[model samples]
Target: MNLLYKSSDESATSYICDETGYYLIRLQSKVSEQNYKAAYSAVLESAKTKPYQKIILSVIDDDENPLSVPFSARSWFASYFSPQFYKLAQNQVDVGIVKPKTKLQTNMMHVILGVVEKTNIKINAAYFDKEEEAKEWMKCPT
Candidate 1:
């Protein structure tokens, strides 16, 4: 995994794995609007950097410094980011999300993925408890 972007506060880090053709965005705890956009900019850049269409989104809980996603950030993602991203990928991207530890985080994933589905993008997305499993799943044809 090569580092593509890291948040200023180190709360988020995005990686690109050329081997798996998967872009990984690992977010720790809370997601502020600024941090979300910074990380998403990297995602857009990654799509432009290569035709890679797989994404492994991992949201991990940090017992030491727990944070939550703000409503504004979520709204921004649903309203602005998802549409642009899907359009850029031509609705061909497959996203594999590593399931988070807490119920709240898990619910966040549902909401985000749900919003993505509501966008009417023909993308495949699923949740897994293990990252490797998600990667394997991504390797299969949808």
Candidate 2:
């Protein structure tokens, strides 16, 4: 993977390339709401330049803490009803991938997959017991 951008704090890393089609963002730490927003913005900016077909996010919880209640709620809402982002993703690129590790990670993954299934979005996804497997899956074809 071609490293397009690396966060100064080392909390996250992003890669972009023509072969991949979209920016691949992998968070190496337990991302806070602020961090999430910043990552989103960064991905958006990269999208403008790279013009990828989709975004594949691979996030893992560095602390192994359960998804915060607020984060889970927000993610569920966004996955189901975020019309603006969904529309923006419609033609530009699709967003898909595994959720960060949390107590509710499995449930959240199910919810996300259900949303993608219902919406007819071509989101390829999987769960990994290890980050290496997740990375390999991300690089492999659906």
Q: Which candidate is the best by TM-score?
A: 1
Q: Which regions in candidate 1 have their CA more than 4 angstroms from the true location?
A: 62-66
Number of the predicted model whose lDDT against the real structure is largest:
1
Candidate 1 has what TM-score? 0.85
lDDT tens digits, residues 102-131, model 1? 777777778877887877866777878887
Mind giving the per-residue lDDT tens digits that candidate 2 earns over 11-42? 56667656656566666554455555555556
TM-scores for every predicted model: 0.85, 0.58
Q: Quick one: how many clashes does candidate 2 have?
A: 1
Steric clash pairs (candidate 1): 30-67, 30-68
Candidate 1, 73: how far from true, in Å?
1.3
RMSD of each: 2.1, 4.4
Scored by Cα lDDT, where does model 2 land?
0.55
